[model samples]
Target: MRSGQTGDEAAVDVSGGSRRGREMPLEVQHIRDALRREFTSRISMADYEGRAGTDFDNAFLSRALAARAARILTDCSSDEAAAGVIDGRDDFGIDAVAFSASGSELWLIQAKWSDRGQAGFNTAAAHKLIHGLKKLDNRDFDQFNVRLQSLADRVRGVLGLPTCKVFLIVAVVGEGRLSEETEAILKEAAIDFGGWGRTVEHRVLNQAAFHRAVREDLAPEPITIVATMSEGWHSRETPYQAFDGLVCVEELANWYADHGERLYDRNVRRSLGLTGVNQTLVESLTDDPQGFWYRHNGITVQCNTIEQEFFAQRGPSKPVRLTLHNASVVNGAQTVTSAYRAYERTPDALGEAFVTVRIISVNGTPEGFAKEITKATNTQNHMERRDFIAIDETQSLIREDFRLTLDKEYVFKRGEIDPAPASGCSVREAATALACAYPDPILAVRVNGSTEALWEEGPGGAYTRLFGKQPNACQIWRTVLLMRAVRDALHDVRSTLSGRSASIAESGALLIAHIVFQLVGTDGIEEIDSEWESGLNEVPALVEGVLAQLIPLMDHFFGEGSYVTSTFANEQRCQQLVTGVLQALAEGTNVRDLTTFQSDIPKPRRRPSTVSLIIDHNLIPAGTRLEYQPSPTEEQAIGIWLRNGQGRSFATWVDDRRRPLLWEADGQRYSPSGLVTQIWRKADWREAWSAVQGPKQWYVPGEGSLVEIAERLWQRIITEEWSRERETTKDADS
Candidate 1:
């Protein structure tokens, strides 16, 4: 459809009529229908170009082959918009056109509908394609119909840009493997296209390859797996055949080059990026090509039926030879892709590289079976850190339950699109927070480092160890907020701590989450207190305040020396740091004046409330004082006061550090409390015996030694409480 004439001239359709022998494949026909349904020509090109908002014919210029070509563009390319169908008598050699969203890349496609039979591409098909590409190359769409004219105008700006990229694709429904001569011709044509101030990439896709691309997009139709079999090939009672043989690396690479990531469609975790595992595979394939077949696991393919072409044309070591076609690798994606990448990087590395293969052909099973195999095979890959938490039922429940209950989308799977404003947290984030917030400090530290172990349900399962009770969606959401707060705080503190790298090592999250857990008492409900919400909402300030104290404490503790382990998840170090902070808080010995640990020695300041005074004095029995009330958090140490016979009081608190002589005065300077036994020994005989009897006793003034004095004070208070209750009963009776 090329001529020197302008837009007024009619086009010469180079594409002959469709080969009229056979009907289109059912799959291909379905695709054509889908394309026409999804996007049809809304109006005549002349009317559309004229900008007349007229009624559309809808199917005015629908072309099945052109529709398929447009569909390929929509499916495979990024930033692509459907060009729809534009076939006409004067459409030149081009069948379809699509423009990149940014108008920087232009795709021109030529499609041949060979409905009659499977025909290999020859020089004639290649020449027609080359002619169409030349029309684009010469900017010679003069003979083009109104549709191409309209498309050309839409991309007129980018087309002239020196860096513009152009792609010319030739798609066919038959076995049109390009002759070597055709490939060379296209390559030379690509060079010529590049000379015209633009870069060009050429592609040719046959029916089988096209189907692979489409199926990979979602759940694809099962493909036919052609297998070469020896006399040993056998069929069991099942509706499938089994065969074993050598599969060549070259063959694998060819498959990858043809179908690409589609081969790995069943993998739960697709192309792990440039991860160390992927890199290791890549390295092995590149450095040890011949041995790669031995080192790597061969591919697992899914197919509808298995057919064999066996021969006695033995290749040296192998006694017989066979060829397989129409197969899709259901597993061993990393091995195949890495091998492909390796081959691309170093072609010479491969010398007769071949792998032993096992082919299982499914006859009656549905496509679901193949997908299940994919998922099962992929799940067996060496577990990554995320895979552990990714499926934790707690996390899954949170996401699923949240979505159902709150009417919001929650994404726990990787590659899942994040909702706006991040309506959900990653399972990893929730698990990490739960681990840190767990009641025990020992497990919290481990949770930070070993995410993979968290989901284990066996003995000492990390999931059970950290979180035995099921968590609610609301709690998970709150945990997400806490993590965000902690993350923000790390970012802020990083700037203040100069010459120190600003990054908070992932191991540090446990300590930070622990800090938050300590600050905000666990309410057990999913929602946090307003104060915590405020602090977290303030970004990292609350976290920054805690870090401000911790960084210094860490510096002082590790001064001129270092920890044996660099990771913050080092249990001993984490325990020491967290315990130290809690102790500092109990003694009122920190900065920033937080409501709880703001100062160096929190004082009730005012006289004890009248109710407390009654409990402390008149209500107590003659020689005993009141019992102490323990804090709800078994982990946090509550302040307690004890008085001896002299009426002089001593203060103490308990926490992970377990201070014996916790703090005496303002807590500015402190000393170790030694041991629980030593504190008990200070009390009188009766008081010491009492102390030995119950560890919860913290205050009971006037019992000789400090411990007894504390115990006596608590006893008096307990007595007052009992008297108050009796008085209230008397009033009720009156």
Candidate 2:
């Protein structure tokens, strides 16, 4: 239900005036009527009048629209929706605020109710929204109205969640379109707020969508399903009834096609469209339909009642017909959706597929019984795609081979702890290494995008190609060693780099590993030799050389402004970059001549302090765990002291920039640099360095150091400012 388009229209005049000659459009009139009927009693008339002065009608309409948006998007009751409305003076362009039931998603709505149905979201509105978003992100609640202030704690809580998402809902009672210029303005806001991950997105609800929401609200329909279950039997409990049996895949597909998302209205979330796991399900159905019953977890349906059709003198083994009333698929939504997709793609293949089904009837049960069933079904830990691979014969053989041949632990199970670095390697590490070592670069790219692809089975899948024939123990161990070496080298190089270069170093680690594997010549890689192990010594230099060549080649081919993360993940781009890098190496391109690639060049000295930059950009989110990565000298000096205490080397990052690191060692907060000094003093190390660079010594595990992250942010800001200046100059010239 999300789209983007362009329209150019002047902003609506909302000043107090009589509509003597204006005729409201029917769509707007219908929406106005619906809102008046639903929210007249719920809204505060006095507050609206006080805020709007003489423009009460427009204010009321705006509030009503906000309420409707809240109800539609958050699935809240009318009372809650009305309470969410904060549309008035000092509202900061955000009309309403609502959070999902789970409190993991926040929706901030900006509504424009145009009687003439010509509302337009222009650059001015987009800027105002961005300003409000920035204020909220900074936790400046006092600038907002009383209603917004009242929910400050909740808002702050949602914002602090790492996985939380903020959706800016622009609800305009006109055509659902935005000017390209306005769209770019909003996109800039998204980029500013998103940082390394997409935390913000915007959605527009126009005239047609507004009407649809109103109609759907007035008369909501309950979905009913008719399914035949083989060997079905019912357990007649005191308050509820339960039925367990097998259902055909075709029936599930039909149910989904008929009811669509309505079948999962009561579920926590709708089907996650075509995720890797779901894609595998479709593959299973189309490729091996006969084995679907054995491979799949099937579906669960909860209903108000179930009516069974009587069969005269039929045996217990006969199929039973049942009509479910007000049915909702509480679990296995992905399975149902994937089955439908498979059926759509290859209908003939699904005839042999049967799925296990469990039906629960809430008739005469407790009020929250259905919800309890849903919560229980979804809360339990289910098997992931990787879990299936644990039982693979090849993996089992690899495990045995590691234990006997290499004398190392090769853990493959989901809950088993991964072996420490250099001690051994897990299946995940092995797969990534093997993918990087493979002749084809696509495997490396696919694994980089998602490791789920590594476990994908069947023809032309990574799993089939990598482990089709049980790989030798020596090959797996050796490749894993080389990959680990590449990662270590990249980690060191990333510490001194910033911006896109740092990102390329981190995200492109696998591609770099693949290129290094090629350069090292994998002739003796299959055999454990002194020469192969000695070649590991050459990896750091190889990594530097590869990066010097790779960075410029990537820039020359895929413009300097190209997103490093996307380019590294792209198969074609990775292939081309690899080819270009190999060509450059073959031609002996002197990277030292390139000033940007020279290792001896000193970085700019006049940069903002890491703490100030991190605070300004919110680079490291609150409550992020940071680990103390002691330098070799620090390790030698205070390693024993850190190990003496259980949590001495760990700290939690708070929002306070000046004193962000809350040290676990002493339950005290200190600045990053201060913390490092404190650790040195506490360890009583006589050889402690006088000047400590704390940001470089602390890390976010998989991510880089705080200084590296701050540098990236600084570089990003400079790049954006430079781009804006260039655009401005170009426009002036035109």
Candidate 3:
């Protein structure tokens, strides 16, 4: 190993001046030169990529490796290929996270790229990479990726999963090799994956290993099928040998589990769900395990080349065994799926069963013919359209602009970065932000999480619809910035509210922020990002002040939300709020000062959603008790204890008369039994809430219940009646 390992602390000067004074590796130096070439000219990522394969630096190779990782893990298609490189200063020791496709594998990468000899994978770099992963899950860093929050979320998602796997991968180019000390660190660190139920693996690839793996689509190995299938087995010759036989179920299961979707690389669809035909194949295996081959169609696996071996046990009772090499399943995917499932569901039964297998070589077949073979095998299965973002050039261009101009990364594509950021705007983020900023809140309200509508080539596709025509690079960048700023501000504000109020605020956070932005009207996009040439916007104060103005109103209209289908999360409800705010603003009403909350509002019932779902009321309920309680001197606090399980749902409200309504937003209003129902039915005299057998309890901020308040009212009414009677008696005596 030619790695430049150091025993003593490698001196990293405060000024980036190396005390060892060693000449830079030619790889790093060449990379620096390539970067310098860019500094002399304004280049987009597209232009850079167009030239990178030829004249670019070793950093380009690092980027390519990252992209390859994305493609492999995310199963990303070629046209919309994406990856991000944190290669500059303050990278905190990670070249990139080899993004995971799902909530399973996480590959953390430490890359060393050079043009000539090895770039050293020494102890210091190893320590940095290890330290980075340890803290990255918690996101305790200053110079982190712009998509840090979303990435943190992605990591948390995987960590929370039942069984997560983490891999520490080192990709080296040029002279550097993994030194013993560095490898030891990786080996030990690979045991831990930040939480319970995770398995970790570590790998270090030298220069030759990295290039070879890339060239051969991951270190080509001999994939030979060895089996004993003598029942009606034969071979014939087409352009390629067509071998038909009965293969075992256990073998297919093992193959599927080990290779996953990779085994069907050329197939149109891999492992389609339990379709009718697929179920039929599985049913046949379960019902008639003895004659399964005669009943079901066999699988078709194609390969570039195949070499077969045959052997016998050299006994009178023994049968011959055959095996084929270098194979990939391309057709009859559904049939393969059935075989794999049968093995998983009932291996005992499947072992007695046999499935037909057709192995064919496609070495001289045209690419079109191969695809046709794959498509023809599954004409009944409907194919879902791939997301248009895969073909979207605008997203790529915006990502390029963000990289070239913002000096921060924007992951337009999935798996572009490991642990997708919980915050940075994807095309969805961009669309929602643009729509929210579009002087119209309808689109934002309607298409928030609808990936198909939001990213496709229609009304919701703000990227294709608005880009180049209305939005420029500066606007797109600023929209992302402001949206993130608003989210951060909301997170800070969440600290102020009760755990319940905070939850409601969060559900409605996006809409509320859009409202605030609308309130703080922009003159133009230029005004929003005028300082794009310099630093960040003064977002904390701007966004927080707007949130402060909005939360109080939300508190009032939002009620014991525990049961309410989130108005904040619901589109119609969001539209309702948006319209209400717009109407209030139009009416010259001060939305921030709209509601006045008073304590001692009496025992309150849950507020029903009458009309206004955007008021700013307090969450105080009224106290229960009548005879013992003294005459009400002042408004105390509503103390109805909300018993709903969902922590987020609840709010305060008032009727048109300006009296504080005790109920959560329409809480208990919809039950078939209520005072209104009794009144409508003209039922017999009973307690005011005798009909409500199981009403959810709510919390009174300062103390109480609607029953107590009603008691107080009844007492007042009785006392007034007696006083009138006494006055009449006195008048009669006179």
What lDDT does the true structure give each of the candidates?
0.51, 0.77, 0.49
lDDT of 2 by residue, 526-599 (tens): 67554677889999988988888877776789676554554665677789999988888888865442226434
lDDT of 1 by residue, 1-734 (tens): 21222221211122223532135566655544554454443222332222321112212222444455555553333212334344544556566776543455667776554333243455655666567654543334434544465565554444444345567776666665777897887777665544212456677767765555455545664333233333443334355565566666666666666666555544554333223344456656676767766666566666545544435553333344333344667667666766675677676665457665666565667667767776776666564434555656666676777887656556666667666546666665667777767766665655543444455565576666545677777676676667666766666554343211122222255676677676765565465343445445654554655655665666566541232123253556667888777777567675633222222322212334322343344433333433333333311322222233232133443222233323343332122223333333433222333323223334444433333333335434434654686799899999
Q: The CA-based lDDT of model 1 is what?
A: 0.51
Question: Which of the two candidates, 2 or 3, achieves a greater lDDT against the reference?
Answer: 2
Q: Give the TM-score of candidate 1.
A: 0.31
Better of 1 and 3 by lDDT: 1
List of clashing residue pairs for candidate 2: 499-712
Ranking by lDDT: 2, 1, 3
Runs with alpha carbons beyond 4 Å of true place in candidate 1: 1-397, 403-407, 441-454, 465-468, 501-507, 527-541, 559-565, 590-734
- How many angstroms is residue 182 displaced in model 1 relative to the true structure, after the best TM-score fit? 62
Q: Which is the better candidate, 1 or 2, if ranked by lDDT?
A: 2
C-alpha RMSD of each candidate structure in angstroms: 32.6, 14.9, 33.6
TM-scores for every predicted model? 0.31, 0.57, 0.36
lDDT of 3: 0.49
